[model samples]
Target chain A: MTSPVLTVENLAKRFPTGRSGVFVNAVNGVDLTIAPGETLGMVGESGSGKSTIGRAVLRLTEPTEGKIIFDGRDITKIPEGQMRPLRRDMQMVFQDPWSALNPRMRIGDLIAEPMKLHLGLSKSERENKTVDLANRVHLRPEFLRRHSSDLSGGQLQRVCIARAIATNPKLIVLDEPTSSLDLSVRAEILDLLNEIREQTHAAMLFISHDLGTVKLISDRIVVLYLGSVVESARTDELFSNPAHPYSQSLLSAHLPADPAAKLERHVLKGEIPSPINLPSGCTFRTRCPVAKDFCEHEVPKPHHIGSAEHQANCLRIPDGGNRIAQTETA
Target chain B: MSLLEVENLRTHFISRDIDNQIRVAKALNDVSFRLEAGKVLGFVGETGAGKSLTAQSICGLLRPPARIVGGSVLFDGQDLIEMPQEELNALRGDQIAMVVQNPRTSLDPLTRIGDQLVRIHQAHTGGPVTASRGRALDMMQAVGIPDPANRSNAWPHELSGGMAQRVLIAMALMNNPKLLIADEPTTGLDVTVQAQILDLMKGLTERFGMAMIIITHDLGIVAHYSDEIAVMFAGTIVESGPVREVFAKPDHPYTRSLIASTPEKLQIGGGAKLGGQPPDLYNLPSGCPLRTRCTFAEDVCATPPTRKQIGGGHYSVCHFSGALPEGGGPQ
Candidate 1:
């Protein structure tokens, strides 16, 4: 088998509340991998540890445990000083364009900063590259001189993309890149991201709460719940036949354009429990429709379903649910 | 009579420079719309598409440097644009309230959540603080906020993003306003929370027999919730109609493109493509602002077009009003 570009195993992160309270386990044992040129999507609700996992992979926040192997190198325990060079290969695009950027810096310098820092380019070379990156993202070169405050939300996002791509990174973690943008501009940004991937063959860890967008861009999908990977499969397979009860509920809640599609809106009775005070067994057992008494005693392991490539963290799949019938039916 | 009528509403920002540039954005250029007592009008458009401006104008909250240049804002048989400042202020929270997108920014960071709620109620209804607090607590409960009494005293930062937005809605409904302007209230919210908030807004609007102006860029959202929808492009209402009629058959090129671009409608992996950047508002094109990006632009488009009625309560401002391409061709 070909080696994956980025690999993560049982990754976890915990933050000290510092108030004598229990520590907050932001990310709890998430295992994922992305091959070269693959767009892997991580979908979850707020406080589901999706962003925490992304940060852990980048080593931005210190991880409490687990392994992060990037391109044959185990980077989990690497010092911050040595990790600087590795950052050149892995870049991140933040969600909020407004706060992510420095308002005082001009757009040209913002995009050029990455080039100057990592690429060792001269002044004129950096300027030319900045304009080139802007053009790629459909931002006019003339606007590079403008400050972040002057540009609108869509323009600022384009500038953010230009900065992320400036370093020619192999894997870019897109953290809700288009969520803040309006629909018309969002389509444009999605197109630009696809174009960049096609042109550069760079992998992407596309994290978003938007299912529609994830289904469009991601080759494969990972469903997270309360800090655990409940399911992972090919995008089409996962959307068509979601195995986990939480996945089913999430998909059912999505409002499709067609009014005739009978989507049973399952309103989970209780609110999502705090990450600090997670339920004893199966993290999703609280909300899962098919959760049983045994589910409360034992955490579900990743049971292989559909094909060897597909897996789901649900005991119901193995307990006479007819996994073959459900997985193949879609 | 229509419950609300806005005629030739134009909000312009006066330039601070000595040149007296008078940067008249014409945010609402001769825009006209009517809403009945219990109708939901959805304003669907991209950023700087004048949807926000139109909402803020209706609320009479356009900040300094930006003022109503020429228009008549009639609400419930009263002309709001010409009303005195104090009278308008009284009518604002009493008759018209807005639920903004970011509750954190809209809410006062310094004040306790409960205190802010009480203040809005007292200012609008002139009620006692204790009585207002009781009402505020009830309102918060109605919006599905858990433990309203305890949570009310919590600071804005203590609440999650979804919880903060619910608080904003609670404040907006303090006086049971006749019209509620929800300006992308669920834009930043998660889908599940978004669905909950949207349901709450819809239920509250119906329960109070209030007219709602839901400003959003998501077509699916507008289609699901709005009875009427107005598609804006470059400070102009290109198309306005009943939501079903507009979605079934969009007349304006921009509106058609906007609807087609929605991912849910398109085949998977074949998302609709909208070309290039949105035109700069400062240096707008000669005639149709969308001509640059529009696929069916003609010489007549540069001559400007006017709204033409296509059906029941449906209007499109296009030279090719009924001549829009089938299945969104070429654009």
Candidate 2:
């Protein structure tokens, strides 16, 4: 394939808290890379720091440590004034459509604003391209005449996609873009994203909490626990045989749509420890059933599960003791 | 007899638009269903399909600008709609309880969890303060709240999200109600926590022998936990049947589209026609609400269709129920 469009190495980010020395430590040493047209899926629960990684990759939020190299250049600490030109090649779409969109602006202008600023097109030229962009996202041109208030959640998301691609960016970070929408509308949006991915060949970092939806679009999947990467593998590999115990519990917890699907559930017992006071060694040790005394004293790094693409972080991986028994049948 | 029966339930929103024109949004039209004692019925639909409105209407929770223009809600041989406000008020908190989406907002922040539970019980069936407090502790333990003796004193703000939801369920069960309606009870919850809460709800319903109506947009929840399923569209129950029958052989066009949209069943780029935007409430089309997006629409669709019963108590409102191809018609 072509050279990777984005490479993030050992990225770490910490947000300051009210107290003097303590920090949220949202993202801790995340490593990821996306090929020119590949999609990387990041799945984690609240405070797992998946969203922070997305923002850090785009440099929307300044990072505390690690390197971010995009398209052959290191952009970990690029100055905001000089980063303006680079904005044309990177874009992001957030979860809530109502807040992401400008309610005061007309739909046509909202879609055209990005192109108008980035491409510097004339009035008629931008109008022609706006209509074309709307058509590309399967939005009818008539709806463009209305404001954001008149559109439904699905329609508003389409407008956001149209704006994101109007610049023809090399990378796009989508953070739970479809989580707020209904099921049918989510399918339609996923279809639209697949179509655009083929046409533009933009590398995408898809971050969401729903594993089922993430499996639909991502080529590779990364499992996170308490702001740290626990497992990374190919889409099918990760779903079929996840190595980490946290990943195992998450997959078994999902309820399949078919009523006849048998459930082997492993409901974790205690609550996730607050992010402010993460566990000392392996952050997941407190809740992990298979954890032993050694797990609390030593941190585990990435160990190969099968190949270069499949890896997980666990002390038990070396001893082949990471498997946790499915506890109950529902 | 069905524990709860809602027949021809019609609710409309009549309000003056900014232009001062009288407009009526037909929010709920001809919604009817039945629930057996100790059985769970799951409601699945899009955002504006009136799933929650049906629950609110049955409990007499409608406010101004929204009125129950037609129909009756029969619970335990009494019509909830025709009853007086005083009688309904007594029946509501005593016999029927509702748990809404946001657990934090639904709970009172200033009150301790134990006091709130005891107060609800005392309001319905008056007893000595110590007796009510004992009952509160029993319910907290039953709902899987760990260390019920100590956690009872924690206020709403002190409890975690999942813990708060458990307290809400315990409150609903305090009065030994005949029916419980939980609207999107676990929507904002984490997946692992969601499993724990759903399991607790199912266990409690069976133990108490009380009927339940679970209103949610997630089909997975309905498929796994519910005994029956009702698929709603455009403020109407387009299909209702045993969960197995409906999922295996969905008859209505709208139901077929919805089931196919689930991530487990859906094949991306399969070209399955998933076209549906909930109809314009103010001016819904005259005939079939789904005809606009239905690929099999014909001249006959201009006229309304009645409910057609397939085998095993499965019902569908379509002219050609069970006539579509496997992947749906004419995508």
Candidate 3:
């Protein structure tokens, strides 16, 4: 297999609260690796620290501990000056395209800014590439002259994609890129992302709370709970037979768009606990429907389910007690 | 008789621009629907589609610059539109309760959760404080908030997003309302918490036999939760019917596109005919609002399309309703 484009080891990030010595444990020792041209989907609820991992991987936020190897380089602690050139190989697309882009600049200039800063291309070459990139993202050439405020949400996102691909980065982190869009518009954006992935062969860290979207686009999946990895597996294996209790519950909770689909719901009670004072042992034990007494004190190690690639962090897996009995709601 | 009947409802945003020219945004045009007790009606639409406006018009919640120009909202055989503000005020919180998005902002930051529930109950029911307090605790428990006795005293800021949403639902139930309107109630919540809250609300609605209208952008929630569904476009409901029938055989072009766009049904680069600018409410098209974005628009579509009934209680407002060839749009 080709070398992994991005590998994270024991990555952790904690934000200091108002009270001295108190910190919000956003990400806790998350270890993951994304192979070149592969899409790694990160699924979690709010306060799950999925976005933190994305930001920390790109060094947008400083990590408190652990390592990030991008394209075989340990750039976790690299200085900003040294990281500047490496930035060309890593790109990020945020949730809100409106705020991520500048209102003053024209659409063409916005798409061309990255190339100008990194590629050292002449004016004519940059202009030609900007037009080509616009067409690549299915954006009209006429829209290049218009300002961002004049474009719709879907068009603006296409512009953002155009900018991200302008650098042809090896690693791209997309944090809920389609969450803000309408249903139909979201499908279009997903299609564009899929096409770009096939053409550019860029490894992607697709972080989203929507299971359906993640399942549609990802080659592999990682489930996070309270800043920790709970399960990781191939997309089909994870969706068909999720081993972790949290993963099972989360998948059951997702209501499919089709009314005919049978709903076997295992509705979890209560919300995720505060990140500041996370529950000890299994962070998800508080809400896990099948949690046991041992789950209170002992953090479950990753237990491979069936295949080496499919693993879940749940102690009950050995005894076949991880599956929560789901009630048929349909 | 239906618990609520909204007929030919129209709401307009009449404002003056910087040039002092009067601009009227026909936000809600000829919208109509009905709801019986113990039933859930889902309003599904994109942003600026007048789903919330329909709810506001039903409850007489329209503010300045947004006026109800036409139509009647009848609740329990009485027209809410013609009713005086004093009478409407008494009926709003007591008989018709509403739970909106952003649970944190909807709450009164200064008041404790329990006290807020009690205050709302007292304002509507005019009971003794002790009884109100007792009912407040019962409601908190009813909505599945743990440790209601102590959690009641917790401030709004102390509660999490899901907890705050539960408190809002509890507040809406304090008076045993006949109709509940939840506008994007679970928009910002996680899927797990959203399931819990939706289950709680469904249980409450069945127990109390309260008619509910859940306005949301998520089709998944509507598909599973609602008995009937209404698909809205630029200020108009283009389709309405039983949820199962609508999902099984959608007659409107817009409805077809919406269903085809779902992650389960969508095939990448399969020509789903998705993505177009939302209709400009300020300068809406002459007839069909969706004509600009629709793939099968023809010269005849410039004229207004009349509602056609495809089956029992299944209606689609399009000139070519039920006649369009399957999967024959622009590819």
Candidate 4:
């Protein structure tokens, strides 16, 4: 197998709650991998540690324990001072474009910041490159002179895209890239992201709560539940035949835009379990409709059901290998 | 008669310039709708489309710089526009209740949840404070707030955003008003929380047999929860009809654009794209507001679109009503 662009093993991150005696494990034992030019859709509800995983992978958050191998090098323990050079190969498009960009910085300076730090381009070269990157992402070149505040949500998001791709990063993490945009603008932004991915062939870790958008863009998907991977499968196969109950329920909640499409909507009873004190047996057992008594008693280990590529952390598959056979036949 | 009738409502704002010249926004230009008891009306529009402003105008909550210069807002048998100050005050909270967006800002950060709930009941019904607390607890329980007693005592900051929203819902339900206008209650909420809140609101509305107006920009939400859907643009109801009918055959160009633009789960490739930002209300183009970005614009589109009924109570505000392009290719 061609070495994965980025591989994370047993990653965990903890944050000290202010004055509170307890600490929050934002990410817990997350293991993920991204192939070159591939899109991995990471989905979960809010506070599900999906974003924490992204931050941990980028070394934005100090992971308590993990092995992070990027481009065949272990960088988990790399000093913060030395990690700046690594940023050229990895960029992140934040969820909130309005707050992410500095208000005082003009669009040109904002896009040029990465180039100046990484490439050390001259004044005129940097200006030309900034304008070139702006046009590449569908942002008006003239808007480069304007401050971040003056731009609309769609425009600001474009500027963000320009900034992320400005350094020609090999991998880009888009965190809820289109949630803040309006409908038309959202479609435009999605189109632009797809276009950029095709043109630059950059690997993407698309993180979002919107399952529909994720399925549209991702080649594969990783479903997270309470800071752990519940299921991972090819996007098309997963959406077509969701093996995990949590994935099925999430798919059901999404109302397809087409009125003719029939969706068997399932309302997951009860809120998501708090990560600080997650339920022991199966993390999703609390809300899983098909959960068995054994599910609530012991933690279910990951098992390959049908194919090695598609696996789920569920115990009901039965022993003697008949579980996979029965499930596939049914 | 319709429970509430808003006829040609027009809200304009004074410019921020030193001249203080009247910069007419026309936030709700001739926008009209009614809320029958036990029915839900959903408003879908892009930001700055004036759906929220229309809701505010209905409840007499539009603040300075925004004044309703035209139209009559009739509530039940009385005209709310011409209502006496004392009568309007009584009607504001008791008869018509509004759940404002961003519960955090609307909620009092320093006050306990129970205290705020009691205050709402007190202000509206002037009930006994002790009884109000009990009622507040019951309200919280009804809205699916777990551990109502302790949660009631908790400050707004102590609760998560979702919990704060439930508290807001409890306070809104305190008065048991005939009409409830929720203005984008789930804008910043997680999908799960959004679903839960909507479910709670639907259950409460059903139990009380109350009418509700849900103003939102999410097309999927309106498609699922609303009985009737209203597509608002530049402060006007561009399209309004039964949700099923409108979703099946959207007549207006703007409505078609919206239905086309919304993303679908099944679509693998590029979906519908409407170019350009919505027009500025203050400096709107002379004719159809959407003409600047519309693909089917003509010289006649320079004239304002007219409302045409397309059978089964479906109305479309488009100059070329009959020949607008049909939305296709996966939502």
Listed in order, the DockQ scores are 0.37, 0.79, 0.83, 0.42
lDDT of 2 by residue, A174-264 (tens): 9999999999989999989999999999999999999999999999999998889999999999989999999999998899899999887
Clash pairs of candidate 4? B287-B302
Per-residue lDDT of candidate 2, residues B56-124 (tens digit): 899989997999999988999899999999999888767998888899998999999999999999988
Highest DockQ: which candidate? 3
Stretches of model 1 off by over 4 angstroms after superposition:
A80-85, A96-168, A257-262, A285-297, A315-330, B18-21, B107-138, B147-157, B265-272, B329-331
Q: Over the stretch A184-222, how does candidate 1's per-residue lDDT look in tens digits?
A: 667778878888999989999999998988988899999
Give every collision pair in model 1.
none
Candidate 3, which segments miss by more than 4 Å at Cα? B326-331
Deviation in angstroms for A145 in model 4? 2.8
How far off is residue A108 in model 3, in Å? 1.2
- Among these predicted structures, which one has the highest TM-score? 3
Give the fraction of reference interface contacts each candidate recovers. 0.36, 0.74, 0.81, 0.41
Displacement of residue A276 (Cα, Å) in model 2 is 0.5
Model 1 TM-score is 0.88
Model 1 residue A273 CA deviation in Å: 3.4
Cα deviation at B177, candidate 2, in Å, is: 1.8
How is the predicted docking of candidate 2 categorized under the CAPRI scheme?
medium
Can you list the residue pairs that collide in candidate 2?
none
**Lowest lDDT 10-residue stretch of candidate 2 chain A:** A321-330
Candidate 1: DockQ? 0.37
